[model samples]
Target chain A: MKTQKIIDLLDEFLGGERIKRTRREQAVLDLLDKLERKERKLLEKLAEPHDADEIRQLNLKLQVNRAHQEKARQALESWAKTGEAEKSDDGVAI
Target chain B: MPACWKSGHCLATAAAILAGAALVSAAAFDAAFARIAAGAAIFLFGMRFMEDGFAALTGGTLEHLLKRFTTGTLRSLLFGIVTTTLTQSSGLVSVVTISFLSAGLIDLAAGVGIVFGANIGTTTGAWLIAAFGLKVDIAAWAMPMLALGVILVMHPARGARGLGNILAGFGFLFLGISFMKDGFEAFHQAVDLSAVTAHGLSADLLFALLGVVATVVMQSSHATLLLLLAALASGQIGFEGALAVAVGANIGSTATAVIGSLGANIDGKRLAFAHLLFNTVTGGAVLAMLGPAERVVEALSAFIGIVDPTLKLALFHTLFNGLGVALLAPASSRIAALLIRLLPTPQAPGLTPRFLTPAAEAFPEALNQALRLELIRLYDNAVEIMAHGLHLHRRILFGAEPLESVVERNRDVVAIDLDSQYVERVESLSAAIVGAISRADAKPAEQAEILRTFQDACLDIVTAVKETKHLRPNLTLYVHHANADIRIPYNAMRLAVGNGLRAIDQLRKEPAEHRDTLELEALRVRFEQDDREMSGKIEAMIRDGRITPRMGMSLMNDLRYTRSIVRALAGIGRALFGEADATHGAAERVLGLSDDDISRLARGPS
Candidate 1:
């Protein structure tokens, strides 16, 4: 529903900060895949309230992951609105 | 003498002289000796100036090349060869390699690789002298070189000055060789080197020993090389004698490097040892194959259409060094590992000052160097104590663990016992510095004042550590207090003090020339500002029922103590560094706190 140019998408995500990756990282980045995966139970633990130090640590990591996810989503949304794609991790574009 | 002994030839000349000194005219001998001595001095000055010029002209291109090319052992070897060949000084190459290794710019294997190649590179100087100096009318070239050198020296640019020095060095090198050649040729006109040559192991040992002694006395191998080559060219000594002298010269060349490394770190010593080992092993291997090596040289010389024995000796010089590289360079890593075992760490695990030796107290410069080192030691101890007083681990403080997390981890431990650490690490060295300066032989007043200023810096460090002792009790109590009002201010103090310690530790590592004292000044200003803000915060807390009046009073006193501690540390900011330009105290303009800044902080609201 948004009308944006291809250049705007590239500027938002790829200006100044370049990943300069190859096709392998680009493929994973295009699909918005997490870099690594673990048991869903670790994610389940992160939803609980911070009651202990370990819980606090888990909360901190999830906060970092959440921030990363938000950034990635913003980059993808800009690309969807326009014809251009941000530099993917491996530098491939879909 | 090391050169003569190594060559197994110079002793015969000495004996022949002892036999014939009564026959020779005293004036003639004295004149010949004078020319040789003067030539050596000129040659040495030229060599030194040339090195200085090269260093200035290259800027840091040589360093860059060393960094870029020394990625692997083989690459480092080639880079070393090229750098040393261009520089014409193996000692210079060794110094560069050692410095690079110390800076963590290159790995040990790479440094060792360059060193092996440098040994081979030094032989090029011999080639220059033997192939050209012996054959040509050297004075013809020397005059023009000196003329060009003077012209370049007249230029205002630093690069031109450096080029001029290089030209002058070239001129002197040839001129000295010519003088030495004439002196040897003059001696040969009356006497023969043939009378001294014994064809056995004893002859070999004698020449090698002579070479070592001559190098030691002269404190230079290149000078000794010039003398040896001059003798060889004039047939004052035979090929066999030159070979032995070459071996000795290699061994004797290590002395200056070893002496230079006296106050340096284990890495520096290790590099020196590596140099010594390479030369000795190579020299030993050549001695082992001396007869066969000679025949090989003779065959090679015949093949190359060479008639001059001097050129033949130059070929041998190149061959033996190349042989050493061939044999040892492949095992450089093994040699480095062996060196590490040979010269293990001097101290086990704790902080110790290396520069506070008896010799340091013998001269103003040495005393100054020692004092600088002791102050650095004091700084390191202060950092350790200050960092731990904030309940932060030493490793984590300087590690990847975020400073916030490091500061936050002080839930249960107050690990700082300041008095004992001060006694153990600071007091003895501080006392030694004072003692050394007092005993230093008749130092000039300006240098004495500089030492006094460093002594004052040591006092500031001790006082700062003492303040940490007082701050520690409050620091632990207030950091995790139930009251947010008190805890937040206390935590801020911890961060400020911790950051101060980190900055000082960093500045200690940086050279005096490169320090941005303005950044430190800004930080000091911020610390002063923090005191004003902290006082306001404490008053606000008392009004807000966040802390009682009694608690506020205690907090205020502690805050004042915090101010005192920071001021004490900042007090030495200039004194520790201000002594560089001792005569005019010009270093005072750039280093540490000015008197006004120190007084302002001292008189600030507490």
Candidate 2:
């Protein structure tokens, strides 16, 4: 599943239709995939019954991932609005 | 022979005979005068023509040789010697040396070496005249040589014709000498000229002053020396007077360099001072040891078994200069340092207000080096501005409270009016670099690459700063996106910026040696790799639906902009390295990157 997701992202990145996306977007996509996997694992563990310690650990993990995702999402939004997320083939960003 | 020789008639006849002798001698005098004048003209013209032809043939090659081969003082000295010998003019060599110094081709020490060698090379002409003229009776062969020279002048080959003119000039010189000798002989006997026996300086001071005055008028020590030789040969001037004139000639020759450096830069003026100080000190030393030095010359002459005073004088010229160079070579650095101190620093910045001085502009290498330095400075300022913009970007992106100290400092530092002009200047400088790069055909591919990169970097920095300024209301979203981007692609961009700063700084510090081609290539590759990785991350984030469409688009554009800045930085590095080949690859890559990848990277994880 992760491989397929990565392949899809790579395909999308390489596609010529989008005027804005570039190689830098692929890096962000990879990071997002890792975050998603961590989040999915955390949710699966949360569905099971657990002792107080395990429940607390799960919550901590969930909170950390949520923070990471939120940070990533905000950064993405900034990139989107600024149209600066795509690494120009020229390799310069203001 | 006519019967006009008894009593008053005899006396009248004797007077007429004397007058006839004077008339015949006067005609000889005219002939000699004509030959000397013609010879001098041919000599001067030949010197110039030969120098120009040699300069044309070897000017570029010599400059390349100097630039490539001069590694130290010794090599520089040798280079000066070789060039002066080939050109046959110390004055020309000094001018070239000064130009090299002004262009910053050689450091102060090496320049001194070249100056030293040039002084020695100039004496060659004097030796040639003294040695060859004193040998065979050139007068007997002068007519034939002159005729041959004239015939050769009509040759089709310009160079051969020039050589012919030079030979003809030499013949005329000898012919002139022979006539002058006869004219003096006739004048002495026919008229008891009291003016020729006027009392003059037997004192050292007066003799030295005479030497100085003569040299100043002639503007050449060789001419002064030759005149002294002629006077001595005629028995009109004593040896002491001739020697005094020689000393004064040394002092007078320094005027050339001093006048040459009138409005020149600090280095040029310093070099002129070096010339003056060297001559003065050597003259003083020679004066102090005049008795001993003369004895040594006599002894050396005896040892060499040569007997002519003219030859002795020529040897003295060589010996004095040789001694001066030997004594002063070790102390050259100290002398140069003292000159620098005496001149003091100029109150104003910049060497000259004009961009390129006319003297400096003549040499292409010098002009190119100056242009390169200007570009490096411009690139450095651009990097600083970009760094400032990035700092502002970070502040606006994160809702983290602005540091109070920074805010207070900014309040004082950021005079809106002043900064606005500075900002505009920076923008204009970027545009100027672009324009210059576009116009340059010398290194076309390299220049184009540099221009494209510089433009991209300028745009990125401007956009980043402008967006950061506007991110006040959207601080929350901007901060979140920035944090995520910072971990991945932004991290690489930041590193690229750091590397770019280092490269630019290297150029600033040591432009001559720091234009490393390999390192720049490696940096370029790293930038490309980072951009590729960033693209992948951005795509996955969008595919996972972690970020909204609006957020994704924003992320894409911002990261693309960042990469563009990196590309531009890379371009600057390539230009600094003088590599034009990589520009096409950079351009192709820029065209190939897509916007979707940028959007995905900006969106982050689901």
Candidate 3:
């Protein structure tokens, strides 16, 4: 998720080093915050002595979260630098 | 065949009939039968006494002898003769050979040679009976021997007590022989085996059957041969019947090995069958050439200036056994091949432990060694799974490639179904170990204790695999985190486990004798040190404002996962590869986390 420090670090390149928050960036933060909370809660709920069947499920969740976090961080960094989020082949700024 | 009897009855019907015959025969040959039965009982008791003494005295040096000196078939054969002579138990010697053979300590040829030599060695009992038992006034001599033997047997020390047992066995054997001799002398007046001995093939076959029945019932060919010899010397049985009985005794001796090898490993079963085959074939050949064998025995008897019929029988016993060896020794390698073909290594579906075969469970040392070997396989599988869990391949960890490079290139996450792997490898192997241990005939509390430790070791490995499975997802997520604050800490955790595992893998490959638990304990200590450094790194990163309080909390929880993976692997290594194991009981405690130390560590966060 995009923390305040990350937002400021991005704004330094996007808005001439000024501390400003755009509506688009705010939406991004809100969505990222919600995702992070959901992932953390899910992780906490999945208890110990994880039996044979449950391990794969746990691994897939962690894998997707990690991949999503990395992709999101990259997009935010690019948006802060060039006033545009990175676009995928489908033209979605993910 | 009877409607009254049930299946799996063994020889219950035959035994009942034998018992009835003995009761019927008692009235006619009452005095002599009484002395012979009492003597045979005493003789059998002495054999057990001597066996216990030898075992207590020698400890585990027999394993060393099997490991080192058995370079060729001849040496192993000599070893068989010498050991059986000392212990007065061919069955014990044969079982030990089978144990060694199954464990791959000695090759199959060496094992075959030893069994053949044991056949020859067992004839020494017949010689003892003939030379000392029949001719000498054993009752008077035995009294002093029993007296001396009791005093020594009462001694507190191991070797001394063992010596006492040997002396006691000697005394009892002589006394038993005297009783049998007197019984035979008395019985000759009432009945003679010649009356029943038919001419030609029927005579040879009938008496051989008698020999087999007596041995099977008594469970001792030595006893059977001794009885036959005493009966022959006292004119109760003809020389031809004695010869047939001698052949039967050879065939009968294999029963012990055969019964023992049941439910044993493939190699053990093969060895036992080999034992049966050798004796059966030898007996057949001797019967085929009975006339020639008798003439040879008579010639040798005259050359040695021996007039006693019992002595001539002893000479015949040695010659026939020697003939068997001479016939089979050249084909020892071929016999091994034949045995292997007859009993191919079993191939159960899925995965089973290669080392924990029924043959390997023939004796305690072999059983323990096989268990250790299987546990090692479990560890190797675990290492592979753990490497995959951390987004790296086993090759990357075990190979010359840098661990960092491998982790970095692991951008394309490899999918590993840990559940399938566990089911196929760990679970199956663990169950096999438990089953093998449950079946292990390795006697006494110490052997059982070793197997228990192995079983516990298997549990530790399974638990280790399970822990790593739990840690996998978190390890994968954090190790490649977006922020350097989180990324660096997680990587450190991964590296800690990776390094420890790699170190242990190297240590595991070391010769079993040199691999020390202390070294494994040191690796574990370093794992703890790595944990402390990671905690400090996380704290410093938080203070620098690189990560939020929430991020720091996640790393803390994830760090515990990483720490656990390392701990489980360490636990496995300590159990499977401890150099100071009881097998090396004779050696001084060198270095390793002593049981107390490991217990303290297990108690948590010292």
Candidate closest to the true structure, highest DockQ: 3
Q: What is the lDDT of residue B72 in candidate 3?
A: 78
**Fnat for candidate 2 (0 to 1):** 0.00
Q: Report the candidate with higher DockQ, 1 versus 3.
A: 3
Docking class of 2: incorrect
| lDDT scores of the candidates, listed in order | 0.63, 0.51, 0.65
Backbone N/Cα/C clashes per model: 34, 88, 5
lDDT of 2 by residue, B527-557 (tens): 4445666667776777776655555565556
Best by TM-score: 3
After superposing candidate 2, which stretches have Cα over 4 Å from the reference? A1-94, B1-60, B134-202, B349-606
> Model 3, range A1-94, lDDT digits (tens) per residue?
3485486547565643223324444444544554476568558757666865366445444434443444446545666755433233335332
TM-score of chain A of 1: 0.44
Candidate 3 per-residue lDDT, tens place, B340-387, comes to 899986543546778877678776667778888888888788777777
Order of models, best DockQ first: 3, 2, 1
Encode model 1's per-residue lDDT on B1-606: one tens digit a residue: 122321223333443453354234334566566555555445444544444455344313333455569877788888878887775657656755554554334666777888888877777777877766732355577889889997998898765876787787677666754654454444443323334666677788778777776665544556567778888877778789888887888788777556434433466678778888888888888887788999999999999998888788878888998888888888888887888798864442334567978777776777787888788777777767777666676677676565556676643343233544666677677677667766766443445667677777787787777777777766655666657787777787777676666655566568875543323443455556667777778778889889889778877877766666666565556556533544323223222344455345434435
